[model samples]
Target: MTAELRGTWLYDAHVDLGTPIMVGPTPEGVRAIFPVTGGRLEGPRLKGRFLPHGGDWARIRGDGSIVLDVRALVEADDGALIHLTYGGRLVIPAEIQARVLDLANPDPLAGDRYYFRTLPLFETASPGHAWLNGICAVGVGRVVTGGVAYRVYAID
Candidate 1:
């Protein structure tokens, strides 16, 4: 069954949160520029794919596309569950690394503790960046109001 995801409010929130208003060149020429054009809500889920613009930044850059797919489900007045999955790949030269899938409960206790569950299901197209595996951690945080931008800190 297809789920209805909503992203308007959160999209605005991301804007107010100062979600990088510009697309700069990638630090690594091999990487694609992110958050391209046309990112919006597909119902209750936030779905978007970004690609590097055609330029010097897009040269050595591989076919690695940045994928952002998220689903939001509200639990209570102040609690919510967000399921997110994202991945990047380099198809041309065949170099992929740091593929991550993390499940986060931003409001586990609905107020007190935040929790995260990470699946061991991760792989790299090449071993050159395999070291990224050991340094990965599933993180969870609550969006606290900072009067300016959205602030996310470890809840516990």
Candidate 2:
């Protein structure tokens, strides 16, 4: 027997960031830092803007897959603060990876040549949004023009 997975749409996150700071090849992978400037989140359950000074620490592994470690904050309409943290992986074929690295192209990842997914955790102290603290969430992400977009869902 198999169990079906169900989830509710929690939020859509649009994150803005500066150019990645490439750290060159490391023992583990090619490291880079993407500075998160600011952005917004909109959905039925929560709506807010991302706090500044947060960013994603990404690593392009030896196999060309990208690993992401991100941290940020969301302030709901009611002023409740939710701390967001997630780790994700971006898997792409070698041929696609080569195209994505092309500097001449406007949008290297303009097509469906990759898969990006994440597991997100939320933390909050406000009573109104305290339910987030105990929920398990996941997200599907894509590389957008300026940054990245994620459709987050709460597992039910």
Candidate 3:
């Protein structure tokens, strides 16, 4: 049998970021640490703002792609604190990889220009929001002016 993705557009999390702390070259690749400043999370199932205490420690690959390792805390509107961590890949076109990492570019490329996909796993102790723990989500992300925004969906 073949598989299909009948997804429910669940929520969106617009994560803001501060300057990246460059870790220079490593055996694996170039490392950059991006701090989460503040952000807005809005959607039908999950709604809240991101707490300013998480970051992305991403390694830039040789082929213009990014291997993402991110962890963050989100506070739901109802006061529930959720912990989220995700590792994914972002494929950048070779033609624009340099400009994409140049921080000073001041412009975000259109979302359609690259492939930014993520699988996010969430955890929370709040009974009301425990459904997050049982769902597998697919996140389609884009680079925004000040941050990255993810439109998450649950596969049905």
Candidate 4:
């Protein structure tokens, strides 16, 4: 038997981050830390905002791709707190990276020049949204002016 992959649009997360703190190049890659300031989360089933103090520990690989390890908290409108963790990769072409670096103001509209995606796992103690713990989720992201935006989907 074969299985078909299906997904449900879960939410759009607008996450703000502080400037990346460069950790310099390591044997694995060039490491950096991006502090999560705060942001909003909106969708049909889940609606809320991200709590501050979370962050992404990123590594720029030898080939210029980015590996992202992120952790955050989301507080639902009803006061339920959810733990969010995701790992993703950002593949940036050299030409596009050069263009972005050369520009005084990088255009977020040029997001098509690169690919950013993540596999997110959620954990919650709230009974109302407990179903989330059992399902797998994925998200597509883009770098915006002040932060990153992600459209998350639930694998069904």
Candidate 5:
């Protein structure tokens, strides 16, 4: 048996990251934390801004791919608060990473140049946007001028 995969646009979010706090080589790999300074969100199902209380705890693997461990809170335009967490992989060459991760660099790169994808999950107590609780989602990310923007889609 086979099941086809389908999806619907959920929201678009632009995440701003603060300076990274590098935790140098740990057993887990080269660790670092990119604070979630600010963000904005908008879409058909929901409209909101991401609270600046979370961050991305990324690790550089031996293969050079970075594991993205992100945590964030979303405040829907109506004031409903939702927790958004996602785990993913980002594969970028060291040279590019050095340039892009620098706060000094403001040039946006084309996402097709590297691999960046995320599996997002949402949780909330608000009745109006409760549909996000169980819906599996995927976010395709792009490197913006100073941050990363994602177009999230709900699996249907």
Candidate 6:
């Protein structure tokens, strides 16, 4: 099947958003850790997965998947603000989970406070001439603030 994002206006449009996603300074420079995987767009739904940093690797025994959904809506300042939904278990130990209540919430945990803030706008390699169907970013934090560095990734 042809890649959904190929030549789709969002390709470059998303790039313009920026590189080295900004994140707030937290303990351990830990805010800058996001793992992205499975970025494939299906029909009206965009799907992907995100893995937070410092989480227990043992928790993700098998191939883990986080659900992502977005619309084609793009704003002038925000670029493409597609609503995202993440679903999956965090790798933190049960003891840690008890303390970090925020781990369950995708938005806050996926931002600046913990490890999510380090995400760059583009983390996946472009499937030549194809639109991205699914994309995932992993990390732990609260509020993906401005200040954290980012690194842009583009597949040729």
Give TM-scores for every candidate, taking all chains together and pairing residue i with residue i: 0.18, 0.88, 0.92, 0.92, 0.95, 0.23
lDDT of 1 by residue, 25-97 (tens): 4564433222222211222222222122211112233344332222222111122222223222212212212
Better of 4 and 5 by TM-score: 5
Clashing residue pairs found in predicted model 5: none
Query: Model 3, 17-82: lDDT tens per residue?
Result: 889999988999989999999898899888999999999999998765899999999999999999
Number of clashing residue pairs, candidate 6: 30
Candidate 4 pairs with clashing backbones: none
Each model's lDDT comes to: 0.24, 0.84, 0.88, 0.87, 0.88, 0.26
How much does candidate 1 score in TM-score? 0.18
Residues 35-58 of candidate 6 have per-residue lDDT tens digits of: 332122222223222222211111
State each candidate's clash count: 8, 0, 0, 0, 0, 30
Q: Return whichever of 2 and 6 wins on lDDT.
A: 2
RMSD (CA, Å), each prediction: 18.5, 2.4, 1.6, 2.0, 1.2, 14.8
Our tally of clashes for model 1 stands at 8
Better of 1 and 4 by lDDT: 4
lDDT winner, 2 or 4: 4
Tens digit of per-residue lDDT, candidate 4, span 1-156: 888988999999999887778899999999988888899999999999999868999999998998999999999999999999999998878867655423234466566668989999999999999998999999998887667889999999
Off by over 4 Å in 3: 102-106
Question: Per-residue alpha-carbon lDDT of model 5 for 11-108, expressed as tens digits?
Answer: 89898888889998988899999888888988998999878899999998888889999999988999999999999988887778766556547776
> In model 1, which range of ten residues has the least summed lDDT?
147-156
